[model samples]
Target: MFLEATWPLAPFVGGFCTVRHTLGVSQTPFDKFNVAYHVGDNADHVAQNRRTLDSFLPRSPIWLNQVHGGRVVDINESNISECANNQLDADGLFTRLTNTPLAIMTADCLPILLSNEDGSEVAALHGGWRPLHKNIIKQALRFFESSPEHVSAWFGPAIGPKAFEVGLDVVEAFCNDDPNYKGAFVRHPDNEDKWLANIFTLARMQLLALGVKNIYSDDLCTVEDKTRFFSYRRDKQTGRMVSVIWRKYP
Candidate 1:
């Protein structure tokens, strides 16, 4: 139903991360566990699915509108109720409060979870190429209030480099920003200007450069795993899967 990632660095860094697949009661296309309300999934079905998700979580998760931008809001007691009714317009969420889960929805895009060594701070990011180009990860990192060396990150399911074909503009977006990023793209054999962009590699490079020494990726490609995930690039109108993270109380 869901995959979980546990933090082993410290007991105080107490939180668990998980991402759901299309393995629930949701109908076809959404199949099951479709959490996004904007994707035209039935409101009742989506609501019920969320309730099921809430049952597993200590507190309700903070859902975002996810405009593919870099803004990250800190979840607080007040924001939780507001987010339940109306989602926040941001690509990332971070919180220091315990039992407050932060969630990011994705389909072919990356869902990233971050935590500090002491388990005092945790964050979730929706990392699309657009936001990656905009430095959303860096934006999210700023809220950690800790040095990058003390932070650990986990990359969730996304379109793999081999399957994610792109135009020269996509290649240029990162390469133009930094020449070192050229390694993240490979020119397609059939098309001189076309390239295959590696989302995971790019994300790792960004995290490493930011001084984050501990980084991990699930290496699950949503585009290739039809049975487990929803890929907008693969299904076009498919529903989204969510990656959630939160710090538990000591």
Candidate 2:
């Protein structure tokens, strides 16, 4: 849907595109569209899914080995030799070059896409609570050589605030770093010390702090919509969805 909206057989496939979803061969939840070999899915299915996804985009979606950390990597320096069967030490990727699609796979984690005012460069980041708490946005904001005001972002589907429950330690972790984090957390109804976090709300806070106000949010809750998206929080075992963005080749 993103590609169809962006480029439609424009100047041949010289730019980049992104895809998300874990691949599995006839697996219950991961029946198809799994792009990564991780998450206990069938490896061959993932490879085949990659081939199927190729038809929709100009370049292969550069995937990440997400570790729920704030580590962001420049695409030029990415260690492509690495495999993603296990936890990846990094969670975000950026690229200023064309034909390099930035993508992240997520079930419940937020998928973030960034673009400069001129649309010269693009990046994608996976933001679970861990990555958000770790300040991945701060890193991404720093990595952009362009002015912060010129940067625009799109927030994809994720586990909404109503669905996310966290312990006091989680709240304390954010507070310890900056008191501004407190605004993102709200007391959970059933649990005294627990909190219900709104990732969208927190993300806006973070982006505003980064000085990027042009933001678009899908407001889709993956956990709530089983048919359109995959949700890890709603179901422990599930497939992931790919969210991506990139510039076109002139």
Candidate 3:
């Protein structure tokens, strides 16, 4: 099933995050609704699941070969065919085309969806800590024809602060970018060298700093909710959930 994103986007824009439910074809650790073919799930099952998902979408989604970097591909009519044939190696995708859903697959990493106020442009980002530290949101924002103020962002489920622990290096990397980022990390209760990172807070801070005002979140923690999500940190071998957004065709 889907966890529909309820933001104030134009009626023509659609966005949602997929959940691992009993209705899917994947089995065992994947156990129903695993969408990524790179995750070692059966090819046929993944294909079937994608087909099932496609039935709900206007057109087949443009998936990426996410590398957890800041690269974002422009998905438009001219490059649409090439994009479908070659899963671009990038962490984000942007497109203004109608019904061309852009998807990002993740287990614990955040899935961030964006759209302009009038629903003319939409983007999907694979927001892992590496890409976030690299300011992937900032890169993705550049694709919007409008300024940051006119863009709204929807944050899908990811590893929450309480469950996402990191090292001093990670904290320093973010804080080095901006001392304000220090506020997003706190010393782990039992380990002085470790910190509990608030990815949601960090991403929100980045978006706000970039001048994006209308931000929304599902507030669901993938690590904590095993029934509805897949968490790589929690389960070493697991399936990936997808978050997608598109401008509906008239």
Candidate 4:
């Protein structure tokens, strides 16, 4: 069975989406559609299943060597094959053309997708705590030729706010950057230095800062929903899920 699942987040662009969250029965968390080659799943099986994924879309999803940074790659026909080698560890992807899918693999981190409302351009981003701290979403916003008003965004499943805990450093990262983050974290009186961070709200803060009005989020939690989603924080050796998107053609 294909382990890929569709995003429940609203207003999917022509080909914008999230893949299914699944576990490999033999491989613990890496059993199903573990698109991450670095996670120790069998390489042959990963390739075989990748072909399985190819059958669902018009072309291969341009993959990445995710490094949790804010750098974005532009994908075009000339670089599709070379990209497989020089994806050179980027955290986000953008494309103005159709047919070539731009995608990412994530576990607990947010797999973010952006598309112009008229459907001429699209992108995929990886946002965990580090990249978020570095303003990766902001980098993405700058890539679009259109104003934020003409752009729409979709956020894939990530760890829920309630389940996400951090020390004072995490809270300080945002607060130091912008005091507007004061509302995004709640201090834990009993825990002393710990705070609860709302990743969804964190995402919304950036999207709004760019004047993007159409934002859709999957309230789904990778940590809590063990049956359907994988969580690196929950399971260290977990298989990663692919959240992919491509322009649709008639």
* Top candidate by TM-score: 3
lDDT per residue (tens digit) for residues 1-250 in model 1? 4766644643554333334453456687887778888888898988888888888888778888899888888777776677767887899998888878888889898888899887788989988898888898899888888999999988888999878989988888898899999999888988887899999998998999999989876688998888778889988887888888878754
TM-score of candidate 4 to 2 decimals: 0.89
What overall lDDT, based on C-alpha atoms, would model 4 receive against the true structure? 0.75
**Candidate 1: misplaced stretches above 4 Å?**
6-23, 77-81
Query: Which residue pairs collide, candidate 2?
Result: 20-242, 22-34, 23-34, 65-88
- Compute each candidate's TM-score over C-alphas: 0.92, 0.84, 0.97, 0.89
Q: What clash count does candidate 4 reach?
A: 4
Q: Candidate 2 lDDT, tens digit per residue, 1-250?
A: 3322132222322222222323334365765565666777777776777676666556766777788899987765345434223235688877776666666888888888777766665678888888988889889877788888888777778899889888889889888988988998999989897899888887888889889888877567877877666677887876667776666753
Greater-lDDT candidate between 1 and 4: 1
Considering summed lDDT, which 10 consecutive residues are worst modelled in model 1? 13-22
Tens-place lDDT digits, model 4, residues 1-250: 3333243332434443333443232255576667667888888777866786777777788888888888888887787779855556889988877767777888888888888766677888888888888888888878789899888777788888877789889988899989998788997756877898888888888889879888876567889977667688888997777777776542
Error of 2 at 241 (Å): 1.0
Ranking by TM-score: 3, 1, 4, 2
Off by over 4 Å in 2: 1-26, 77-88
Question: What is the C-alpha lDDT profile of model 3 across 99-163, one tens digit per residue?
Answer: 89999999999999999888898899999999999889999998898999999999999998888
